[model samples]
Target chain A: MSYRTIDRGAAATPEPVARKIRGLSDRAIAWIFVAPTIFLLLAINIFPLIWTIRLSFTNYKANRINREPEWIGLRNYERILTDSDIWLNMQATAHFLIWTIFFQVLIGFALAWLINKKFKGNDLWTTIIVLPMMLSPAVVGNFWKFLYQPQIGLFNYIIAFFTGKEPSSFEMLGQVNLAPWSIVIVDTWMWTPFVMLICLAGLRSIPDYIYEAAEVDRASKLRQFFTITVPMVLPFLMLAVLFRGIENFKMFDLVVQLTGGGPGSTTELTSINLKREAFEKWRTGYASAYAIILFVTVFGLASIYVKALNKVKER
Target chain B: MAYSKLATASAIAIAATGVAHSAQAEDLTLCWAAWDPANALVELSKEFEAQSGHTMNFEFVPWPNFADRMLNELNSGGQLCDLLIGDSQWIGGGAENGHYVKLNDFFDNEGISMDDFAPATVYAYSTWPKGTPNYYALPAMGDANGWFYRKDWFAREDIQAAYKEATGEDLREPQSQKELLQIAQFFQGREIDGKTVYGAAIFTERGSEGITMGVTSALYPWGFKYENEPGSYDMEGAVNSPEAVEALEFYKTFYETATPPGYTNSYMGESLDAFKSGQVAMAMNWFAFFPGLYADPATGGDKIDFFVNPPQNIAASTLGGQGISVVSYSDKQDAALEYIKWFAQPDVQAKWWALGGYSAHNSVLQDPGFVDSQPFAGDFLEAMDGVQDFWQEPAYAELLLAMQKRVHDFVVADQGTAQEALDKLIEDWNEVFEDEGKL
Candidate 1:
């Protein structure tokens, strides 16, 4: 059959199907189309969140499901807030998040700016630099652990060669002073590429004519960079920061594989502490309270950050 | 027509086999830590499978994750394991939580006496009230924290002369905790056969129970106690005793000045790796691993020697072992009980020891040639005689994590003084007991 004939046949639906839907309004049909999704959202996301909020007020242990949980009137929240060890975990988390975002943005922007210049093998260099981002964080954490090994690791050997110190004199993952930095280094190595790609997009998005226009006004190269290049890329840079900020706030797998929050709790992030409470210690109710607190902190901060990002975009 | 005839014939054959064995066969799964003994148990269960006409399966988790995995399984009432050989620390939780079948009635009916097992194993691995006759499991593997060393290095003449010159004493097996530290310090960063070797590999692992187990080896020898008196929960002076501080400081010294670089999170596997790879002069691990270590081609035979954790104020070894129990949730309880029955036989336990699984049976342990059976056998007996265990309370996970943090803070991370760390540990334990309503 001709294409037009088939089209006509499809367009004019059979009489019974058309009559079945004849009385329905567009909104009702739309609801029909979206109801399953709404049901799923309620079942999986909303219900669990509400349950967690309820559990946060109780003294429930997940492993002891047979025992009835007693209502403790926010005692879990009270204790978690007062716990000194928890404060230490928060400080460790803040240190990790701030340092990782700082290094990633700094190095990521530099690499993106360098690569933005049309040079030989530029695409190949971009691909090579982005290789670390492609790897699983767990895998990155695992291999970096070996690399940070003090005795026979390549990292120690490199430092020794330059500084003329013994290779085994310093331990990156074993020392309280160095362990936090060790995690920062691995995170920068693994995730800087992600930030770079975002920054690269920002760098590429700036029209070349703007640079040409600045040059027409006899602007210096440095002047063009400060006035045009930086201002134009600020929004994307902020977006990358927001993403890394929220992600690093809840960071677990990479740091866990690398440090398992040791050398004291020097590298124990808030998320690691949460997991220990919830799963290892089976303090489900307390961990629920802990999770809610972390959620509020991140959500409140990110909401403010997104508003700033939008304002930057408008500018 | 021919197909129908063949189907009928097959049905007749099935019925004939079903009639021959009235109790229909079932597949039974037994879960335990994945180690040398699990492999031995798998080999040993082949005989049980043949006799019982039941297919045997296993679920073996690594030691680091065994408690977390198996406890979750039992807590959730998962049918994964019909029988479980769980850690000694888990007995209270298992029994009190109703995850394990109460085996007292089964034992009574089957005529299996708990008296046939070593008293220490029976007390440590099977009881919830601890040292009581209330049984929840059969003591399967008896283990304790023990030490091994490079005998070949100790036998070196130049080393002996160097040791004599350094300390004005003979270099031999460590007689006490102080001497052990002295020898370990001597080996640290010393060149041996063109390779720079560390002093020793002890457990400094932060996650789970590594540091607690390792530090307790030192603590127990110094006469450390969890409470001022037994069952009192009064830990102000005892848990933070001067002896505990000294022991903690000694372990910290070992970690800081002696052990291999990047040995912060080392545990049983790492200890084994250090010994087998010839990286350390000495190492600490469980007696359960000794058979495999002895049979190892690379670092076994004349090259190795074993010692119980050396005494300081008193003789004590950290108990390490587990008992076998039928999970209450299992539908195949009869089959699992049959396996347990077969396992308790004297002959089977003797074969179990022969195959590298530590048999706690008196028949095997009291045998005249038991010491001569293996080089480390005498030390194993000595260690078991003095074995002490950490809290086997249902709140053990909480109790253990608290110690892991406090000890790791002092010893590995250098965060606080040993006295301060122990004080914090007592506070943490106090909070846990209060929550459990036992204080």
Candidate 2:
């Protein structure tokens, strides 16, 4: 077990094998473990991003392989920037993002606050409320479509019962004014639970001693809630908003199934429009440019939002 | 002993050849939209499988996603499909991009005459350069926009009396576009059998090609043409002409006044459901669904009747349905060709019609008993004769999407004048053409 004894035995060993063992440095060993993953990331993610950026500069029609891809530098970008339809799509996406985030935060916070109170079957009630978030969005979109049907949809029937309007009189996914809201309603229903769960975690994380200290000072319940609970939960709420804002910006499948970006493009989000351009129209080059613009917008906004979230966390 | 050994070797060689021939059998996959006709095709293809010694695998995507799925498959040169039943508008793209096998040699080798198939279908579904003989597909299914109405309700004595009193004509199938409007207006919100029903259900879907398909039924009869010259993309006057504007306006008026409340984005499925549920007096749909509608015990049988889409100034029906094409990327080309050859026979075409598919073969269509084969058969013949299709350019998706947005905006969203909508559509299409260097 002594070091000298071990060194004497090592001195008697063959040099080639010992040299081979010492040849690989710790840095070299680290690289051997990491190279495959780095190569894989480059192949799957970074390479595609670079390739997409290159394709964005060419006039490439995916379906027309017979034709050569012409170099049309800045033309695709120029056209997309000037396109009125694209601007309208941006407006639609912004509208959806703001409203969905607004509703999800407000309602989700309210639900989480209610569930945080000690009550009978609170765990069961919380699980039931989060079920919408658990279901597949595609399934929800399809069923929500039925629910918005003017003739037989229960959603319309419920609205009619409350408002004294005919069930078939209003078209939720059919009218110009109402179609946008229809998508909003469905998105809110499916995702509010996600926001609720995050808000609940924030609520539960607040220590009981903070409230106990406030109670000793004879502060009102409403004042204590505003002074302590609201501030404590603000960062988590901001984090939830940031997640929702990014997700709703790229909304496609649900809106596609629900309104299909219609009652005349009132709900055509950026993602749906991009898909139409790339796949349906086969304008791969133009779509790539459009996609890059979208990526930049989302990345820029998300970075700013995260900074704000971190600042709140520090506070 | 040498002669006997030679005989045994010859017998073994013949048996080996026979085994190799049997082993050549393939499992060919045919891709198409999931629809009533697709189900019927599954039944008809059994005969082809039995005859050709090839098993068939079907990939049927829903109509909404069929184009996206199949086009991606074709564009990626995927071998998922040996044969594709592509939409009529896809002929130009498929042919130009070499997604479809050039069938001129195959047709000649198989002795399959293009003349035997319906000329309109051959033009719409086979040829890439419009009317040229450059064949890429075989006309498999023929469809056109036609009207189905509640004949039982129209024949009610009291309702007939009321219609006569109001319009001084029998409440029958409409003969003119104006009369169709009048009839629709008469039936709008009308009570029948203690239930209130609306006038009609037409295409208003906006996500894909529904609005364009539905509106063109009205547009064609009003003399809406895509261009002044056949190949030229000069759509300034043709698409937004005064007549086309009038036709579009009439369609919007009909939609606004006659259609059931909350029928905003209805397509084939929605229209069928509306009719089957007895919510509408008239429904506009493709001829492919007539057999199924006629067989329905509740709303069909003796209760319903169909008519050719009524004319405005010219007689025309909007063409639908697809042609079967061998995928150029298929590994099983021989087996795919065999399926087409077997499917093109006169007897097989007749059986196709009998199995609820619209057979485009003239041998089946011109049969003496063909018109009497089904209730809507005669109207189908008339409609097919006058059928017109939308643009079949390589950039057809762009053109079609432009029309969908423009038409849906005007007709469904009530946003702009018909003239403005068509003018905007002309602008959108011209941009696409300019991008493709066609302008």
State the TM-score for model 1: 0.96
Q: Which digits, one per residue and each the tens of the lDDT, describe model 1 over residues A211-280?
A: 9999999999999999999999999999999989988998999988888899889999999889988888
Query: Highest TM-score, which number?
Result: 1
For every candidate, give the share of true A-B contacts it also has: 0.71, 0.77
For residues B65-145, what per-residue lDDT tens digits would candidate 2 score against the true structure?
888889889989999999999999999989888899999998998899999999999999999899999999999999999
Please give the DockQ score of every candidate, comma-separated: 0.71, 0.69
User: What lDDT tens digits, residue by residue, belong to model 1 across residues B1-439?
Assistant: 9999999999999999877655658889999999999999999999998887889999999988887888888878899999999999998888888889989989999999999999999999998788788999999999999999999999999999998999888999999999998999999989999999989999998888999999999999999999887888899999999999999999999898889889989899999999899999999999999998888898899899999999999999999999999999999998899889999999999999999999999999999999999999999999999999999988789899999999999999988799999999998999988877788
The Cα error of candidate 1 at residue B407, in Å, is 0.3
CAPRI accuracy category, model 2: medium
Q: Top model by lDDT, which number?
A: 1
Return model 2's CA RMSD, one decimal.
Answer: 3.2
- TM-score for each model: 0.96, 0.95
